[model samples]
Target: MTDKRDFAHIETWVFDLDNTLYPHHVNLWQQVDARIGDFVATYLKVTPDEAFKIQKDYYRRYGTTMRGMMTEHGVRADDYLKYVHAIDHSPLEPNPAMGAAIERLPGRKLILTNGSCEHASNVLARLGIADHFEAVFDIIAAELEPKPSPQTYRRFLDLHNVDPTKAAMFEDLARNLVVPHDLGMTTVLVVPDGVKDVVREDWELEGRDAGHVDHVTDDLTGFLQGLLAKG
Candidate 1:
């Protein structure tokens, strides 16, 4: 763990809502991931395998698969978001420890996600930590833009009136932390802890040593609690 003193200046704790907040071991996002592929396959009338290729391609090229489709094929963003996020969230049990850890933070909390607003809401509600965050900045809020893009991060910072120098961002994807780091926010990469039992992409596991990440943790709740302890 990085010294908690490193986080003493942080006044805004920004978090990504997916695998970052909740442990990815639960595989809640795998359902959404599958749904994305399902949406792509059906919408494009292609095989599932082909959809898989396209989904990864679009995600790598355009920040999000839906955004790629929107840019190239004029796909309806609303339809795509709704369809892909239509998953049962009952598997997400509440983590009171995490709630307590978050509640003990020194300042405001916000969620910045590439996912939809409703999806972020559902996940937080299911985790029983919805009330901790001040607001959620979703894809639509970014005007259908996704993270790793400097523009989208700027929009979120402006919308929330956040000072990047005093903020800290936590995300599961290493690539998503780049712009935040560049903009002077302390960047944290939340990893999967070598739990290969869950569905995940190899590329998703890349880039911890690329220097954009200031801290990395496989156990978010524990990490947060440790921060408090050290602080």
Candidate 2:
């Protein structure tokens, strides 16, 4: 657990779409991961093993593998998005509790994801919370710039007219929260529950004392419920 902070001033709730909205154990990313590796392999004419390495390298360097592809090989964003997000979304169960909690929160709710809007829509629909969000600020909306990039965050805020001081950003990756924190938004990191020996990706791991993070939780629905309770 991380230090908790007051969120009463937050009026715009910005949520990341993937692990932040759904639990990590669902392993949905595994499907997308393989697809991305396959795409990279096909594009570069490399072995799957080599493609996997490239995928991680790109993710580390460019915030997203697709961004790397676009920058390096001029791959079409739409084509890559269509290919990677074709996986089944049944792993996500409909979360009515989360929907209700989000509905109870005051002001606007928005999704800010490094993924495509189409992918975000599918996940939100599967969770039965698609209608709860006012709008989705996706990779395309950010002009291919991904999270943790100050430019991407700036674009989202400008397009949506969101006030950083009155916003709260929820994300699974701690590194992604740094820019949001610096911009005056409350930052929350969502981790898996009761997992003592969890294996994390290099990007997912962050120091607990990092001042950018304000709160941490495993249960997103319950966390939002608690926030609403405080009000």
Candidate 3:
């Protein structure tokens, strides 16, 4: 199976978890957000109202709430992850179809996420797709550098021994996809509804259209199926 289309050039496929792999409307993010709020309130001795506001502020400033907490609030990363993910994992359910799709995809697959490896592992296990990826690059894996930063993409390429030109990045966030596109990797955006707004970032190479991402789709299984069919 060989075709000259853009996505066919990718020898390595990097996936952003969370909203990318699964449907975002599932409301899982709200649970995680609430956990962060609870953690902040308990550990920082702040009211729940103040804690949620500060946590959102941290996310806006540092990309990840843990980053701000570690830098300014002096919170430890492991401690924060432990506290935040202590919430109910029942919201996550196995997706055998996604797992099968992952197993069938050609080339190497890796997960690059801003979340902790513990969280990535738990989520993957819950999704039943943990065995498909060769490696999991989480928040700690990139030295705390998160998405939308070219540094994280560079670090991911280096750490995974991947060539940027031969890789494809699948992300739900358009802003995070910018650096990958700038680095010469083909970008795929997964918008489950086909109605979500794209996120704009500050570091994207100006004049290059973010809409020119190689492909956009509603789900990982459909995306992978389309990619395989193109081969």
**Candidate number of the best TM-score:** 1
**Cα misplacement distance, residue 29 of candidate 2 (Å):** 1.3
* Residue range 18-122, candidate 2, lDDT tens digits: 888988878788789889999999999999999989999999899999989999999999999999999999989999999999999999999999998888889
TM-score on alpha carbons, each prediction: 0.96, 0.94, 0.86
Per-residue lDDT for 37-145 in model 3, tens only? Answer: 8988887999999997888788877887888888887898888887777766667789898788778877899999998888888888888899999999988888887
For residues 1-231, write the lDDT of model 1, one tens digit per residue: 443326989999999998999888889988988999999899899999999999989999999999898988889998998899999999999999999999999999999999988999999988889999999999999998898889999999999999999999999999998889888899888998785576778888888776788888999999999999989
Please give the TM-score that candidate 1 achieves against the real structure: 0.96
Best candidate (score: lDDT): 1
Looking at candidate 3, what is the lDDT of residue 193? 63
Q: Give the runs in model 3 whose Cα sits over 4 Å from its true position.
A: 1-5, 194-209
Better of 1 and 2 by lDDT: 1
Model 2 worst lDDT run, 10 consecutive residues: 194-203
lDDT of 2 at 230: 81
